[model samples]
Target: MTPSTAEHPQMSVEDFEDLARHAPETVTLEFINGKLEVKPVPDGDHVTIFMWLLRQCMQARPDLDLHPEQGLKVGTYRNGRARPDGALGPVGHFAGQGEWADPAGVLMVVEVTSHDSGTDRRDRVEKRDGYAEAGLPVYLLIDRDADAVVVHSAPRDGRYAEITAYAYGATVTLPAPLGITLETEGLKDYSL
Candidate 1:
């Protein structure tokens, strides 16, 4: 279930939105550097991991609101958009209507690795820079390939200044803004 691109090589945000309106609901696309990056639909393991994390966050921090597949405005170029696996922010931060929400409203963004190697690389590298540049406080990456969770924080210049990685079954402490520890017990490895 790889993503398919449009005939045009690049597109503006407005143009991407227009195309998305007619696109199938099952397809997930991210406009990046003027090109649409089609994302594969989530498999069962992906869904299970996402739900588990969402529930954990909700239970641990009832003050924050979590949204799945929520679009984020990352840069001023209008050349891209980012939709994290899960976005955490103050309650009602995304209550309005639009194709994307301001990155300022997002406290953290989480990305779970996909089966595609390219996608996984993008999540670990490209998207990390993008989120940092956008000034998001945290970027939590659940890397199935490594069977570990990595947290990136303290954005500076165009990257996170601090990073900590923990294997499954270990607790990862989120910094001040989040002020909570994520217990990774029972997290399963990817079967793909």
Candidate 2:
């Protein structure tokens, strides 16, 4: 059976943390606005693109730290936790944290669209808003469905004030703090 974006039974933060700690490693769960979202494990292409982007970020900004599947606390919602495809922050910003990093310390959040429609929607839409609302400086979205990379920045009033998009093979410049142009030359489209 294939996993879909069906919402799982809601659980408190403590319960979710306990389950997350003891659950099988195969389970990919996220708490979004008091709802437990069971996300499909990323496919190979997703991983490939993510790693490439991660490398780019590292090479461009060695001063910052990047991690894959890093959990984050967005806003004051105790039940909501976000695990971005990749998260960027100052080195050792969350060094002593427990299971999640504070959004205030995060400089950017990256999300690579999943093949699943619901998952894609969440990454492209819901997470974008959530990240902005959390006051994140940037939200980088690699949308396989649309074959484009979008950079959302300058968050204000629960949204980003600036957005720049580039199709595959085009370079997208990330504003200061990141201050780098991402090379999308080898980023694969989902259609392939």
The prediction achieving the highest TM-score against the true structure is: 1
Instruction: List, residue by residue over 1-192, the lDDT tens digit for candidate 2.
Output: 333221333667778777777878898777765566777798999998988887898898888888888888763343367888988998887788877777877889999888885865578766777788788999999888788999999999878999988889998889867897788988855436
178 in model 1: Cα distance from truth in Å? 0.2
Tens digit of lDDT per residue, candidate 1, span 5-119? Answer: 2233375678777887678999888775446778778888888889888888888899898789998877434246878899999888888847687787689999988888577
C-alpha lDDT of all candidate models, in order? 0.80, 0.79
Clashing pairs in 2: none
Where model 1 places Cα greater than 4 Å from the true spot, the runs are 1-9, 76-78, 189-192
Worst 10-residue lDDT window for candidate 1 reads 1-10
